[model samples]
Target: MASGLFALLDDIAAIAKVAAASVDDIGTMAVSSLDDTAAAAAKAAGVLVDDAAVAPRYVVGFSADREIPIVAKIARGSLKNKLLFLLPGALTLSYLLPVVITPLLMAGGAFLCFEGAEKLWEKLTPQDESADEDAAMDPATRERTMVSGAIRTDMILSAEIMAIALGTVEQEPIAEQAGALLVVALGITALVYGAVALIVKADDFGVFLARKRNGAVAALGRGLVIGMPTFLILLGWVGLLAMLWVGGHIIIDGLAKFGIGLPSDLLHAATEGVAGAGSLVAWLVEAGSAGLFGIAVGGIIAAALHAIPRKGH
Candidate 1:
């Protein structure tokens, strides 16, 4: 009886030890996974910045009261796009049809370039008088239109973000890749929409503070109210540039994958050939080259569209 009891106690101890080790392993893996995801997400900073810069414009022209809710709606749509549609599709493609990834990425990148170029063209041209009339006519319709447009745009940007992330972690096990992508998707969506919420509301917050009795508070409020428009205009320009650069970068990278490596090689040699050039200079050169390439492609597409006679015209 004594021997049996001792044996039983030993078995329990071994089991506990095994459980502890298992727990430690799981904890270590979780930490490593998060770190990897963060690193991968960081690599896609250009797209992230463009995402942030483009989001606030959707809330423009809305009443102060509707800003936050509109942002929230867009945020929810963004989350759905990333998680529900893009995530599974990305994983499936990465696993099953890996060869197709590059072309698809280039396609999406071209769409982004086209969008950015169209916006630029609009900025250069005068707005139609009917645009003002439409804005004054139906608030609900305008809000829905803006929200739909934003979400559609978000889908393309989200696809790029996820594809870049997947490329970074392609060597990992599928499970780990899924976990990391989930973290990235949730994290980026929250960060982008949260920042946008704050941006759209800053003017209102400024007005509130401006109405306060404290001098400093009022001054700060006034500053925010005055600064936001200029800041937004600057942000718009940044967003446009980001779209061009990131889109061009994607296409250049994709071209290399498809046995056409000259562009990438030339870009590298041109940048690296600079004497005493550092990483920053190389990066800037690469980005500039990519942006120029994207602009050229986008310009051709835009001109083609312009050539096609519309129903009204």
Candidate 2:
């Protein structure tokens, strides 16, 4: 009876040891997987900044009362786009047809460039005030139109974000890949819309602050009230350039993947050849190259698109 009890104790001890080893292995893997996800998420930082920059303009021209709601509507749509559409599509493509992903990313990027260029064209050629249909829209219709447009833009940027994440994690086990993409998708959406909400509401915050009892606080608020518009204008320009830069970057990457690597090679060479320049210079060179490329492609697309409506008319 004592011998039997000893044998059972030994068996239990062996099982415990095995279980401990298994847990340790899983812990190591989980840490490594998280590290990879963080690295992958970093890759999407460019598009993420562009996403945030692109968002605030949609709330422009709306009444103060409607601004938050407009932002909310767009945020919901962006989340939906990421959680429902882009995430699953990214995973599916990774499994079945990974090769097509780059071109699709490029296509979306081209659309972004077109959007940026068209906006620039609008800036250059002011519209007739009396003939502005969208401006003539009722408040509700205008909100819907703006929200819809914002959501559409979010879709592409979100796709880029997910695709970038997918590229980094495609070699991992399916579960880890899914987990990383999921974390990125949720994290980025929360970050972007949260910042946008703060931005759109910053003026109100400023007004509130300006109305405070403390003189210093009030002065700070007044500063924000005065500074917000200039900041917004600056943001608009950033969004525009971001569209081109991101779009151009995506197109160059796609082209390289397809064996048409000249643009990518030249871009690399140019960035590397800058002698004695700091990291900032190299970054600017890359950005400028991508922006120029985007402008060229976007210009062609914008011309065709603008011409089509006139011909139809």
Candidate 3:
């Protein structure tokens, strides 16, 4: 009886040891998965930044008290689009038509470049402004319309972000790929909306501070009110550059994979020839070349599309 009791204790100890090892393995995998997801998501910065830049527009007409809540609602919608819709669709595409991922990604990249270039073109070209009569609208109706528009826009950008992320981890196991994309979807939505929340409320914060009697606080508040616009403009510029860079890189790399490597090879050689230039310079050179290529491609596509007449018209 004593020996049997001792044997049971030993078996229980062995089970505990096994359970501990399994837990450790799971923890390690979770860390590794998160790390991989972050790296892959970073590759999709173009869409991420565009999402961030565009989001503030949704809150423009809202009262200061309602800005954060509006952003939160949009964020929730964005999350739903990503997790419930985009994530599963992306995973299915990755699994079923693996061969199509690269070309699809390149297409998405081209679309991004086209969008960024279009924004630039619009900036350069003057528009004929006709004075249009305004219809009176209730505030609630306006807010609802704005939120709907923002969420609809987010759906497109989220799709691009998910596609880029999915392409980045196509080689991973399906489970890992799903996990990575889940992380990216939640993480990026939070990031973009969080930044938007801050942006829309910044002026209100500045106003509050400016009302303070303290001289230093007032100065700081004034600075914030002054600087927010400039900062937003800078962010837009950054987002445009990222779109060009990322789109260009995707096209160049996709072409290289299809045995048309001349452009990339030439760019690489030219960059490499720079004496004492490190990886950073090489990356910049590559990025610049890619941006130029993307812009050219995007411009041609945009022009061609513009030349076509609409069927309904």
- Scanning candidate 3 in windows of ten residues, the lowest lDDT window is 1-10
lDDT of 1 by residue, 1-313 (tens): 1122223323322232223234246555444455444433433555666777888888877888899889998999999998899989988987888778778878878877887788788888998766565466588988988899999989878888788767655655666557657766776787678778888888989999999999999999999999999888877777787778877777888889888999789877878786367877876787788888888878888899889999988
Q: What's the TM-score of every candidate structure?
A: 0.81, 0.80, 0.82
The candidate with the higher lDDT, 2 or 3, is 2
Candidate 1, pairs of clashing residues:
none
The models' CA-based lDDT, in order, is 0.74, 0.74, 0.73
Model 2, 87-153: lDDT tens digits are 8888898889877777777887788788878877877796877767888799888888889999988
Clashes of each: 0, 0, 0
Worst 10 residues of 2 by lDDT: 1-10
Model 1 residue runs over 4 Å out of place are 1-43, 275-277, 309-313
Between candidates 1 and 3, the one scoring higher on TM-score is: 3
Residue 110 accuracy (lDDT) in model 2: 87
Model 1 scores worst on lDDT over the 10 consecutive residues at: 1-10
How much lDDT does candidate 3 score?
Answer: 0.73
